[model samples]
Target: MIIKVPGSLSIGQVAESTGLSVHALRFYEQEGLFVNAVRRGPGGRRLYTQDDVDWLNVCIILRASGMPLTVLRRYAELVREGAGNAQERLALMREHQERVTAEIGRLTESLDLISFKVGVYEDLVDQGDAAVRQCHGPSLPDEARTPDLRHEAMAE
Candidate 1:
């Protein structure tokens, strides 16, 4: 499925190659996140080129890293505009990079706490009287507890 497909590729081929469902491909199209318009063939079947598949893979990675659909659409728009918007694209990517980095730190801390909690449980399970350790984390930052503060703070 991961061939350097020449000419036009069917939606199924693209999906298989990119590890996305056909529905997701359609959703991305509907969300206007594609740099190139998906061309249609007989019977209005969506056809994708190799470059489109590559772009979809990139989009998949960005989405996996927690990029919001809106932001991704904006990034795709910037890319579609060609060369002049490089600065804007870079700014958006840099912002996302910072957010992703912060998230990694948060996840690492959480995993460490979880690992420690596991050890606490293991010790208690084996010896009936082990000191129960508390893994207290910071109160859900104002952002996690509040749903509407996205506009006021770093939502990511």
Candidate 2:
């Protein structure tokens, strides 16, 4: 029902291009999630320009990064309104940037703690010392064993 040009993509094409499903594309359109409303071709089929795909890519990333749908919609509205509001957009992005940075810092610290725990466990295996293993986390009993099951297999 529609004739598409080289640079224009149908809704199906846009879905494939954006890695979003047709239903998701329709929902995003309904939610006003895009910076520009999707265009329509001669018979009213949805036609997406390259810029639409690019915007959708950005929206996907933002959503993946945990931006709320409401915030995303606001950002789209600001972008669609065009120019003169770069500062507002920057402020919005900067806030999210700060949150992501803090989350990264927390995750890094957690990873370091995990690494330290792994190191402590490794020390038990390297020394094969039951007392040290007990002091670290587990009590050495006659039948007690380190959590690493490979030791049992190796002993067999």
**TM-score top scorer:** 1
Locate the minimum summed-lDDT window of 10 residues in model 2: 133-142
Would you list the clashing residue pairs of candidate 2?
none
1-156: candidate 1 lDDT, tens digit per residue: 344768899999988888899999999999999999999999999999989988987898899999999999999999999989888999999999999999997677566545655765687778676556444333446545334332322321
Model 1 collision count: 0
The regions of model 2 sitting more than 4 angstroms off are 1-6, 118-156
RMSD of each: 6.9, 10.0
Q: Residue 38 CA error for candidate 2 (Å)?
A: 0.7
Clashing pairs in 1: none
TM-score against native, each model: 0.77, 0.70
Across residues 50-148, which tens digit of lDDT does each residue of candidate 2 receive? Answer: 888888888999888878898899999999999999999999999888878887765665455456567776877887865353323223342433334
